[model samples]
Target chain A: MYQDWIWGLVGGGLIGIAAALYLLVNGRILGASGILGGLVDGTERAHSKERLAFLAGLVLVPVSVVPFYSSVDTHLTPNLAVVIFAGLLVGVGTRLANGCTSGHGVCGISRLAPRGMVATVFYLLGGGASLLLFKHVLGVI
Target chain B: MRALFAFIAGGTFGTGLVVSGMTDTTKVQGWLDIFGDWDPTLAFVLGGAVVPMFFAWRYTDGRLPRLGGKFPAPPEPKLDHNLVLGSLIFGLGWGLAGLCPGPAIASLSYGGFGGGVFLIAMIAGMLAAPPARRWLDAVAGSS
Candidate 1:
């Protein structure tokens, strides 16, 4: 248990490092929704090969984790309706804001962008409040 | 180029999710289940992210790159009603759906029924934004 937490922290550190490096090296923000969105939006900011490669990396990275991190259990799947609804909502939110958690919370905040700061504050607060609403207020949990 | 960097960034982010056991739906569900059994893995994950994030922010400040022209910094959005409304909607969706963009696509790699639906709806949501914006603008114009 302790080890899992330690590993989790290390993993997160790796993510932050990669995000920084990506900005430094590729000059692109690491927002998952934006990357996925640009693929179909006909943005011309990215070509088909680039889109495919980006999406492929997302899929491939986790696939590679099966060997070392077999301890993970993925059984608690949400209902189809819930999954679809949630995805659509997040997709809309990402578009409206022009970035997702990674882009805003990680990259934007790092740069001290005022918008990122405000967005992240709300992001965290909203997340916490929602959890409270669902788990406590609604008694859904 | 941004394309290659996109891949590298996604790969790194995905790897982090996998290693942290965040790609597992069961794990996320467990953490969200506060009453049944308090799982603190989420805190650990946030903590992990914050530490390196601090250093990354410090070191990268006032830095420039030779190859990448310039950092593709995100333009700050104007703080107004739009920002708040957008965030509230986002929170509502996140609360209702345990799957966000990153986790949703990441889970697809492992194969799950929900992952497909999530992706489909996500795309639909993305597509709807253009028309929605137009509608909002028209309403504003009329008023």
Candidate 2:
């Protein structure tokens, strides 16, 4: 069930459809960080209701399916400090960059937008470098 | 209503994350670990998602949305400090935790305490971003 490449494609197809649906009906790019950041930073008050509605689905669907999937395992690190630090960095950094995997990686890149493409490059570089330093050189992660 | 659409869309996205095995942090980390044992599962996922969206973007050309809202403007191509620096920072975090916003939220439905803690810290970081961004823009002269 897990690690099946076929499932990955199916899932990815579903994600694409979701984004397409959001765009066609809601007329907007579907970016998770942007949606949540707006609510957190108070910059999206005008569409808070809409944002909440979207988030409600994002959060609830997973919860609802938990009973069926039994439980979801993320395999995140046990080191709380590392987790906190990483979370903080993700939160701040994504907001600064204006998108994440959903926005820049999936949506923006699909459109072949220069900005999303560039952003994707930097992020990949960053991820590669971080892994080298921590996972290899330092062996911390 | 548009909210209903958002809900459905969001739900579909969540379902995709669960079904695609994206919610699994190990696979995500594996993808990021290009130096070590790399997994190509996510690449397919990305490819599959992009194909449909590519058409979806084309569908939006010179058209109005059914829900009566403006499509998000294409991002400007001009590079800026925030875009580079922030993306780097995000990448660093992503490598460290392998949890981006989508999985982070989706995980909340049946995640462990560790995931919960990460979410809280992430929220705090988000709240601090505006001021931090202002500081960054000031330091960098707004690119």
Candidate 3:
């Protein structure tokens, strides 16, 4: 059986390499939310084509892999209402904060930027607390 | 050339999300569920990603990017109410759904109807952010 952590390490390494390549070549942070968010808000119109191209690649590559690794699991919540609420929170919050897991957690912390570190800590804390409330306190998740 | 490289970078990143199981909500919730059957895979993923990125950051020190464009300016290091509040909200949402932007988009290929709904809502929320921010700023300024 494939070890979960092993897969994580390998996959994470690829993610880092991708981020590195993006930085080295594009002079931009490989932040998924920031890229997509920019397009949504029309704040990145100048680089809209590039952003679209990146997103196209992001979606296409994974789809191509589905044929071989058909067991890929997304594990999304089944409740539509909850899912919608969660989506809204993520969208608004990430944009308001100007980062997300990729932008802040991966790229930001790697650079030892205080903003990244602080944001990461807060988000983790928030996530942990929410899990406690939802899973333990309310028993609703 | 820029578009091509962007595509390549995104493709590689998507593969990483899939390979690392970051696309799976169960694993994500497990990581957050400290009181339950917590899994450490996500931690490993973060650790593994940081290794190469550390070198990448170092390599860029006092140097221009190979593509001849100015590197993005570093964000201000100040701590503020908005930063903390925004992150807290985001974290709550992340824990609730067990999916973030990267995994959400990458999983769309096979994520079915639910994925489509989440993506549309997420985009709508993103579109609403600027107006919300402006409102918040106005409120903060008044107070």
- Using all chains and alpha carbons, the TM-scores for the candidates as numbered come to 0.82, 0.94, 0.95
Which is the winner by DockQ between candidate 1 and candidate 3?
3
lDDT, candidate 1, residue A132?
73
Shift in Å, residue A68, candidate 1: 4.3
Docking class of 1: medium
Candidate 3 wrongly placed segments (more than 4 Å):
A66-68
The ten-residue window of minimal lDDT in model 3 chain B covers B78-87
Residue A127 Cα positional deviation in candidate 1, in Å, after optimal superposition: 2.9
In order, what fnat does every candidate score? 0.55, 0.85, 0.80
- How close is candidate 3 at the interface, in terms of C-alpha RMSD after superposing the true interface residues? 1.3
Candidate 1 local lDDT, A1-141, one digit each (tens): 677678768766766766776666655566777778887676646445655666777777767754664555445345666667666777777777667666776676666777777876665555556567766788553
**Clash count for each candidate, listed in order shown:** 0, 0, 0
Write down the lDDT of every candidate, Cα atoms only.
0.66, 0.86, 0.86
When summed lDDT is taken over every stretch of 10 residues in candidate 3 chain A, the lowest stretch is A65-74
After superposing candidate 2, which stretches have Cα over 4 Å from the reference? A1-3, A65-68
iRMS for all predictions? Answer: 2.8, 1.5, 1.3
Instruction: For candidate 3, report its TM-score.
Output: 0.95
The TM-score of chain B in candidate 3 is 0.92
Give me the TM-scores of chain B across the candidates: 0.72, 0.93, 0.92
The residue-by-residue lDDT of candidate 2 on A43-130, one tens digit each, is 8887777788889999887667534577567888899999999999999988988998899989989999987888889888888787
